[model samples]
Target: MADFGEILRSIGEFGLFQKVILFALCFPNAILPFQFASVFFIQSDPERHCNTDWILRADPDLSTGEQLNLTLPREEDGSFSRCRMFVPVDWNISDIREHRLNETTGCRDRWVYTNSLYEATIVTDFDLVCDQANLLEVAQTVLMAGILIGCLLFGPFAESFGRKRAAQVPVVVMVIFTATTGLCPNFYLYLASQFMVGIGYGGYRLNGVILATEWIGVSRRALGACGTQLFGAVGQIILASMIYFVRDWRLAQLLTAAPLAVVVVYIWFVPESARWLLDRGRTEEAKQLITKVAAINKRPVSDSLLEKIVVKETEKKGGIIILIQSSVLRKYFFTIILAWFSLNITYYCLSFNVGNFGLNIFLTQAMFGLTELPAHILCIWLLEALGRQVSIMSTLLIGGLLCLLILAVPQGNAAAVTALATSGRFFANWAGSICNVYVQELFPTSVRQTASGLGSIASRAGGLLAPLLNMLAMYHSSIPTIVFGSLTLISGALCILLPETRRRELPDSTDEAEANR
Candidate 1:
């Protein structure tokens, strides 16, 4: 039996079969938000009153409860039409007040509720005053934890079982929960469902990178890896449109979950990665898979093709200890982690707060989702043509600058600020997607998934802080925006300190990575 390295060398690395298999994984990234976006429905405070800061400043005599019916212009456009901004009319004020005292300050958290409120509507039978916001926070936070665990675990599975099985496993797990998340009855049940979803998310995210990079030639790996993100944006679009038609969160969750059943079909249509098969010491299997892929792609694989291939192996196995133990890799690790954290915190904060920006929640989310299409295309284009580090740094800087710009605009200029924030969201999303490719490339192949997972865990750590930022933004005015903006700038600056990975073969070992740095 050939060793895994010899087996991989026997089949030309980064071949057509890997690309097709990776693309199958990309499909889910384009549409898994059905359950993930359930947070929007689950924590909604329909009874939420419009922020009365402007009103309170103008008329100090109005009581908080008395201000519920106050008429306000919907936007800075100064339309003659007036809208009453409040949570759903059915909420019991007394219960809300009690929740405010115990859970939120001043009965606020309306903005935080916007992204996650949908989960409440679908999973829980509770009325308007339920403290679903906290539940959602828990869900979002724990999901990241699952993502952390998945990222750490998938590489071993992929190494032992082969990339196809490891990558496909997430699709199966996601299929199971994506179908069942809507059925969760209690808050805890929903939280568990999200954690499961996060595990799948982590698996898919990592698998997409590994498979795409491994399948494509080194020259095209960045493009192919980043292409997965375009699917994530597509997923956002599909989810946004689905939400428009399926107003009920449960149905929306079901609709999103149902599409993933196509993963089983992949077993028939998709071939196992030749490179991965080789890595696991299965030369014959790798050779067979490669031949079939080459045939399907109409590329002739000559008899000498296997003889010409070579995979040089080094004695390196990266674990948690090695990651923290190496100085250069450790710096890259921490920097990527902080960058991931900053990105997710602001990204989710902006996304979840769409409903609070004086528009229909679905409409706002749709606009945001649609914006990502162009954002991603622009990102993919610029990242390749320009250097990765420059693009990543510039994007983060632009995002942070836009957020700071929002503060200079007056309260009456909320529309301008909202529009600016939307632009910032676009930049941040682009930066984030690009960073996924960028961070993974910085590490050696042997520990690629491990390093990626560590960064992902860090990113999730930032995600865990997002709801808190949303909650803070609700109370501290421009503080949340300012803080997130500052974080982005700091991350961008740190990113500048990192080396570029453009047009370079992935480092095969830590020594290779440090030498390049």
Candidate 2:
């Protein structure tokens, strides 16, 4: 009997219908940044200080410049501080002049934004500054925490329910939550909305890729799966442009969510996976979809050909426990999770570090998104050249080592260090995309989405840690770089133990997965 991929080949692997659906699905891939990484702009503290209205009232005749100088405290670098101000003292000009040396305190009454970039954001609207600064951090933590649960929740659903149904449910919830997030009246509600978005993160990460992978043949599977990541990059560029035009986080967010809500209807247009249908014993539905595919590919298929389609064993195990008990698949499971966790951690750390790159945040952000294409292209080539396990290991090790290179450079060379850092980001981005393809190949159809969901949950654990690393400046500025770099290095080395799935067909069951051993 022909293997599943061979049956696909007989009909034509990648046809017009497959190409169109892949492009359609790429929209959700683009929406990823708006939820995950857009926090860079939304929660930006910006240059700010205590509202200076009281100072103006105290000295009615004083100029705007003089009032600012009197009320706001300047840091040692001569830039006005964002979080500090002087006491509302009734001091005279001599005492006020000496106020530069006076003791400082956190902002009182309310803070004012000194930044011209964003007119307003979730940060400024709710005063997420000074004592309240952790609101944004907490919001992110809640979101990651949601993702951690979402993966476990959604992974099993993809297996028990059909792929098309699993993919649809989270997106509808994502649309509602994301749209409402813009309208959230308080930071707590905003965090609540973020957690909802995180649920969709795991769902989309698992089912979306599997939906694409299960359809395409083995020869194009890596390209098919890794290629969606380029849309994620495209979304980043689109988001950067949206921020530039709108300059208001809520409005920009609404704009992003609105488009997604409109596109939810398109999800119905995509077909359920034929392979998944066959596995479920819905052979008639599978035959019809296969006939549709063959018709699109201009291949002739006889009724006998449809009847001859075979599954060696239709009965299968459920849940993640099957993976845990099986020694052969277990090695791939644990190592891939570590690599994904490190990838997510470092990618965001570099991405959020855009302000330090000496380039405008928009330009740096666009460049970061632009890197996704060539990086994915390089990953696809590497999958072909070095094979899957080697490619995964090489990208992970190279990315990790590059991150460590940042420590060797002197702090004075900001531009050079930024270049080195972006290079590290490039490799980490490549590694993360490749892992998406690699992990899907490591499991069988019965448990593919479940395994992928578990992987996403593990990776998002990195997402949870990434925000805390941003706060590392309070302890030591270099600590984040050192920590993130070390993680990737360790994850890369762990790749040595993962079996390669390069140019290999999707295993149909647990027994077939072990046969790769």
Candidate 3:
């Protein structure tokens, strides 16, 4: 009797059938960037100042420019004060014209923004500047919190529900909430909507990857996994281009949400995992998909071949708790957990480093996104050439070492620092990209979604921490990089302890994984 890999080989592991699945799954992955990183555009704050309404009203004859120049104080850089103005006084033109106002007050009613590229933004709509500026970070943090929460929820849910159900539900939720986020009237409602998008995206994220992972055979699995991230990189670039035209945050939200809704209808075209089907004791359903896929791939096999395949029916259902109960699996799970956390921190740290590069923020961000595509292509080959464990360990090692190199370079040479940092980001992208493929190979199909979600929780945890950690540069320029580099180094050391799972049959349960070990 042949194993599943043998069966896959006979039926074409990466035929036209698998290619369709890859294309469909890549849609959601591309949309992933819009949820996680597009905030850089949506929340962009431009030149603004306290509302001149009181100043105009006080001196009825004062022209708009005259009122602003006379009433508001100038910042050290010669820009008008953004959050403050002189208390309106009865003083005549000469007193105000000479900038002689003694008492100053914060903006009483509202603020004004200069002509900007954006029609409006969350910052302008809700006045999220000054004291309110922190709320913007609050909204982003809430979304990350939702992502971490969703990571916890989806793992067990996907195991209990089928992968198809798991994949579609979040896409629907994401589409609805993401559209609603555009219509949000107030900041609080917008926060709620962003949090929901995060939840749905977090749930969709791992399950989609797992669904694609289960569909393809081992040799091409790394390729499929890395391809999703390439799509995400493309998504970022596409999103940037769209925002360049749309200019309004709400319209950008509506536009991006529409594509994911379209994908929801099309996700039905892809097949559920046969491995997941058999795990739930739906052997007939499993066999049906197998037959269909085999036919579609143009590789005909005898019914007797399908009948000869025997699967163990266990009473235990997979979940996070059950996964940790096995000691060997515990080692594997936690070590990968650290890798997930470290890679995420390192990746986001570089991603958010766009402003620090002494280049245009938008251009730097696009460069960062564009950098991931080739890195992912290289990473896929590295996973195949160097094998999983080696690829992950070496990439993390290289990324960490490069980040540390930034510590040695003199601070004034922006070009050298940026070049080294971009190089570091490239390697870190590969490290995170490979983890997408590597973690799935370690766990069995039963708890695969659960384990993947658990890993994502660690990743989101790192995401949540990165913004705060990056601020450590106020203490020392290298502090944040030093911390990020050290964590990846530690994670690399953890990677050294795991077993290699190259060109191996997919494990269906913890016992199966241990037995293979």
Clashes of each: 27, 0, 0
lDDT of each: 0.67, 0.80, 0.79
Per-model TM-score, in order, reads 0.78, 0.91, 0.92
Which candidate, 1 or 3, would have the higher TM-score against the true structure? 3
Model 1: lDDT equals 0.67
Per-residue accuracy of model 3 over 371-443 as CA lDDT, tens digit each? 7789999988878788889988988888889889988988777777887788788787788887888788788
**Cand. 2 Cα-lDDT:** 0.80
Candidate 3 lDDT score relative to the true structure: 0.79
lDDT of 1 by residue, 107-187 (tens): 332222223434336333433343444555565667667776777677567656666677778877887887777787665
Residue 330 of model 2 has an lDDT of 84
- Top-down lDDT ranking: 2, 3, 1
Q: Is candidate 1 or candidate 2 better by TM-score?
A: 2
Which pairs, if any, clash in model 3?
none
